[model samples]
Target: MKKLTLFASAFLLSLGSYAQQALWGGTNLVSPQINEDKTVTFRIHAPKASKVEIEGDFLPPTKVDTPFGPQDIPSRAPFKEGKNGVWEYTSSVLPSELYSYSLYVNDLKMPDPNNVYQNRDIATMTNIFLIGGGQADNYMVQEVPHGTVAKVWYSSPGLGMEARRMTVYTPAGYESSKKKYPVLYLLHGAGGDENAWTELGRAAQILDNLIAQGKAEPMIVVMPNGNGAQEAAPGEAPNSMVKPSFMNPKTMDGAIEKAFPDVMKYIEKNYRVYTDKNHRAIAGLSMGGFHSLYISAYYPNKFGYVGLFSAATSKQVNKGVTSDVYENLEDKLAVQFKNAPKLYWIGIGKTDFLYKDNMDFRKILDNNGYKYTYMETDGGHIWKNWRIYLTEFVPLLFK
Candidate 1:
């Protein structure tokens, strides 16, 4: 037994010796290393690659003409070769915001292999990092109390899916206490699922920081999958592991709007929440913005606070009887405003593709003398703008 134990110990030592060779610290190379001067240095070890470029939103924007309008897109910067085929580039002083980027080697686009921090937008994945000391400071996990986010499954009878998934976030101290909290039904844009807001938009982190600071009221946030045919996000449902797309059937055709009650019912029944309109808020970005608009209007008096961020006011496809949800918008808005919601907030980027559509929708409200707050920012339909909108919008809820 002593000999066997000694042999086992020797074998473990041998394995440990081999493990150190394939570890992370050996490279001493960091793709994104934040500097004291606020500039970020990115390094990639690709001695064989001839040309390399860093593509991220932090760089200066270049104007690109599209069908919607000319928009400022993220431009790339060349990486100079360093010692030992290590390509490196130091960025200019960057503002405090969550940034995402990809690397191009010889014109082929790919995520930074060195940076394990990444996010998925539709079928594409890009590395993400946060620069602290500004709005993005809220995006980072601080020493304050944190919230609990869970992937829950509930039955949605209307969609004919017996069990569907949703992302629910409960604020800190929720479990220890029995108090009921206001609910914010935060929806995601197209190509996003229940995971979008929490992952890409930093919803959980923002809420935790805001609630801790007492700047925002503690509230329960529910993120539901807007796609009707999809039981959940890609790979989340049984036998449905496929690449995510921006558009899906039955999402905007009123089926989701009709079926939205299932999500609320589940939340109200299973979680400790206030079931009144005054305690309810619904908000989304882009496609999610459209959903929030129609759902709140269609079920007028359901939510007291409504927010649309870079919302796409049009592009509703007709799918049989489900198309009625898209119709009679003026009438629906009339009914919705009759009760005079506590807040009707709208925000969009100046260069957003749906800026005009949002404006057209606003004009309808303007013509009808409806009361709503509007905020416009600089940028297109991207996550940077959406994160800013969320941080701005949530503080004003349930005040």
Candidate 2:
């Protein structure tokens, strides 16, 4: 047994060493240093492969006009191969957001020889590189003013999952300080898990930037599993049912009161979080936004701030406002209508499918005497819109 352990350790050490060497090899992986013009280049030495393409998040499917010239959505950017079969391409202009991309070697997905910063959402992870002026820090992993992110597990009797692990971002100064930061419960959309916001939304970076700018108040952000199912991270299409499991109000309610409480209690006991109404907020996108509406409106005392980004709410439909409608709806919206929270923020893109929803919600707010801020931008349901929303919303928080 001792010999086997030593051999395994030695094998891992050798693989690490080999990986480092491959990174340093001049011909294989070449990190194309991006220029001031935001133009970046890639060089892949795949001489054995008949075809090679460079894929990245620099442009949209229709807007792809790189050296490869107009490829499909998530298409391979063509590379000009050399005498030794080394392929290369130069980008038009890359954005500032972190990107994940890879090489398609004869239709097989593979990592870029030159690129680094590889991460995984599930077992199927991707590889890509960062192209920006100064990305010395992994902004996504940086600490929020009042929190630290820790991966944890909680038992869910309702879902029948023995113990489900999830990620939580505890605010900074949580330890050693008697002060408790407000809790901001965030949820991901469909086809995403608890790690979605931390991974792709760049929530930590947005909080850090907002806190630095003195726009947002320091707070704890909790990301929990929204699906009331055994599947931790399901695919785009969930299992077909006579009626979707998620549509069951009893199941969602049970999950919220039971599984959600398990996560909450764990956080409250383990971290320094406030236990008051003013110090708690809830927000999400898509399905997550639906959860926020149900949870927050039902338990209004728990959250002092509520946000809906491209929300999917029945209350938000393009119907003209009237006093009779307002009277009948005030009770459903919860709260005293006039004095609900510190802020009720709704954000949507003009081009987004939820644009009319935002407008309708604003009308409802106007009719019911409820107060809110409706932020409209030029984007869609993609990460671009979400990131922009975070940039605008975080600054308005904790004030």
Candidate 3:
């Protein structure tokens, strides 16, 4: 019995020693520690890595002059390594906002493994952190009455798609109340899916907060997957990750325009949405803005309010289009304006690369005598400006 006990003890000691070695050799790191002063500190455990760097929208914008125009890119900072192969960088005091960041270990970029809150924009994914108590605080989930965000699968026979998915946001009291609410079809930009509005744009929180404060009317927000070739976001769709070329700008081929009617049909059939032009609104960012423009023009009498944020305008639409659609663009605009939407709003950043394009489109509107509300703010083509556009635009809707 003594010999047996000694053997068991020896085995246990060996196991414990192995565990200690593993713990010492491996890295268990906590990242994006939000300091009390609103400065954020990021950490990475890459002991043998030659270099580490952090890049994010939280840093100052880097201005670069491009052939088309001046462009503002997100700033990047190098991280200093400390004891035990840990690298760290603390940012200056930043405004209240949601920021996405990624780390580069040597030359490979990756999200912080410690942070479960991450967002995928286009082809890249990064860790996200929120700094609270300002305009950005509105973006955070708060104690206010919340809304229900549903990931729904519906059939779109018109687009030849059977199992498409979209996200629907119903305001608080939607289930309890029998009253029908106005609908806002919120579209996502290129490379973004239905999840973009809620996950990255913080649409739910913005609507919830605005509605709770009585600043805006309670409305149903529909976020549809604008990519026609795919059913939903990356992992949500079958073979989506593998065949994402459907999302490529070259292949999109005005699929969103063709598939829009199906989106409306699904929403009107399933939800308690008001079925009137006056109560219906459409808005989008970037490529979505182009979709909004084309959709509003294609079915001018359908939507009462139209908003375009940092829109890709006529320049993009006129590319390689010899169809009747391109031929009658101006005539279609005339007809669209004749219907007279309640609000035809355009919002863009002054420094946005698309600024000249937007200005050119505005000139066309000006020459045609079509009335529109144009808002230009600081910053470039970033979510920061898009969020501001949403906040200011929603209050003016459904009035």
Best of the candidates, lDDT = 1
| 1-399: candidate 1 lDDT, tens digit per residue | 999999999987887787855663357788799999999999989899999999899998999998667888889999999889999999999989999999999999988877889999888899999999898988999999999999999999989989999999999999999999999999998788999999999999999999999999999999999999888999988988887887887777778989999999999999999999999999999889989998999899899999999987874433354377788889989999999789999999988888888888899999999999999998888899998889899999998
Ranking of all predicted structures according to lDDT, beginning with the best and ending with the worst: 1, 3, 2
CA RMSD of all predictions: 2.8, 7.6, 4.0
Query: How does each model score on lDDT?
Result: 0.90, 0.65, 0.85
All candidates: TM-score: 0.93, 0.73, 0.88
Q: How does model 2 fare in lDDT?
A: 0.65
TM-score of 3: 0.88
On a 0 to 100 scale, what is the lDDT of residue 135 in model 3? Answer: 86
Candidate 3 per-residue C-alpha lDDT over 154-249 given as tens digits, one digit per residue, 9 for 90 to 100: 898856878999999999999999999999999988778899899889999999999999999999999988877677888787776553432454
lDDT of 2 by residue, 259-318 (tens): 456666767787777777777778888667756766666555677788888776653331
